[model samples]
Target chain A: MLDDVVFWVLAVVAVAAGVAVFRVDSMARATYALAVSFVAVGLVLLLFDLQFLGVITVLMMVMEMAIMAIYMIMFMGMNPALMPMSMVHAKRPSLAVAVVTFVVLASGAVLIPWPSRRGAPASDLTVSLGQALMGSKMLVMMTVSAVLFATIIGALVLAVPRGRYDRLGDDLRGRVDADQPDGAGQ
Target chain B: MTLQTVLLVAAALFSVGLYGAISQQVVVMVMMGLELMLNAVVLAAGGFWWFLSPAPDGQVLLLVVITAMTVEMAMGFAVATLLHRTRNEDMTDMATDLAQ
Candidate 1:
């Protein structure tokens, strides 16, 4: 009984926040909303007894949003959260496509006949997951990890323009502090 | 009521997010859209886990997905920051200059 209530409440919150991610006018606001939505979903995952995934989701999103906030501050030079900049563009086509996709997918979800239970249920679900992943999907996991590493390297190369010595001088004892080149960093 | 309902909800959320990614001009908005899709993936994984059985594998896959989301967002921010440095604007359309 309580589970049903919790599930519905969470589902509503998650979906609402997901909508807010697009509805909000500013970039920072949308990012925060998305973060909230993910956290809510993480909680729902917990309610479903997926403890490992739920906790990881919360941790991961918090860190991701914090990093995003930093970049917003560093780049936009305004409170990206408060700005009323319109993030939307090309709205009519987007809305049409989104609605059509939703209808088809939702219809399938409601109408399709899913596979029913077969064979005896496993006593330990986590163990079953481990066995399946290790047995069949091990390569997939490795590929994902490798891709993540490459992304990190690529980001670093793009973001950092030059080493510390380039700006601070060879001895790192330059008067570049409080000095503005082209009046940047204001 | 059933797994299909949950999966449908996930699918709707994913499509909505995809639209946002395609429609938004700002980099941050695009990232928000990506996060939305990742959230849907999490939901789908959970639904599979529950309906399939009590196996912890769905949960584990979700853990990996969450981790991937984090790494991707971090790198995305770094790229955005770089772009902002080169050009003071955050709109994707303004990022076309590739020359010194």
Candidate 2:
């Protein structure tokens, strides 16, 4: 009973905050609203005994939002100007799409014949998850690690303008190379 | 608690995200919509694992999805910044040059 109540409450918050994302004028608020929505979803996951996944979701989203905020500030990248800007476009058709999707998915959820439950879950779900990752799913772990490394390098290449030559000397080698605001040697 | 209830919430979140992604002009807002959609998938997956199968496969799938979401969001923001730098604007409308 309590589980149902908590789930519904979190569900409402997630949906409301999601709606707020597009309704808000500023980019910062929209980002934060999305973070809140994800955090609520993460909490909901905890109810299912997915402790690692749930906690990681909250932590990951918090870090992602913070990075987004910093990028917005540093690059003057987002719609942070004093002049307000409308965030939404194409209203009517979008509403129709949303309503249609909800109807379709809700009906499918209700009407579909689900398969019978399988074997019981282990007493320690987190242990099972960990073993699966480091065990048979080692390939996925390795692939994800590669992807994350690529993401870091790719993001830096695209987002950062400076290079060794730019920050360092023309020779591409300076011990105390000077680049204001954001230089190396940190 | 029940699979049906969790699935309902997930579907609702997905639709809301669909609306936001379609209606929003700003690139960041669009990305937020996409994230919400992904979040809905995470919830539904968790619900499935809890009530239906309770298997390792579902848990692994969720982890992969979460990783994908993180990578996608970071790349999206980076691309948005690059686009904004090029034209001093981030609205989807400004991207019409390619079509023309």
Best by lDDT: 2
Q: In terms of DockQ, which candidate is strongest? A: 2
Interface RMSD of 1: 2.8
Q: DockQ of every model listed?
A: 0.56, 0.72
Interface RMSD per candidate (angstroms)? 2.8, 1.5
- Expressed as tens digits, the lDDT of each residue in B1-100 for candidate 2 is 6788789889999999999888877676677788889999999999999889888878999999999999999899888877877677676777768568
Q: Residue B51 of candidate 1: its Cα lDDT?
A: 73
Model 1, residue B30: distance off in Å is 0.7
lDDT of 1 by residue, B58-87 (tens): 555776877677776877778777777777
Candidate 1 runs further than 4 Å off: A118-141, A163-186, B53-57, B96-100
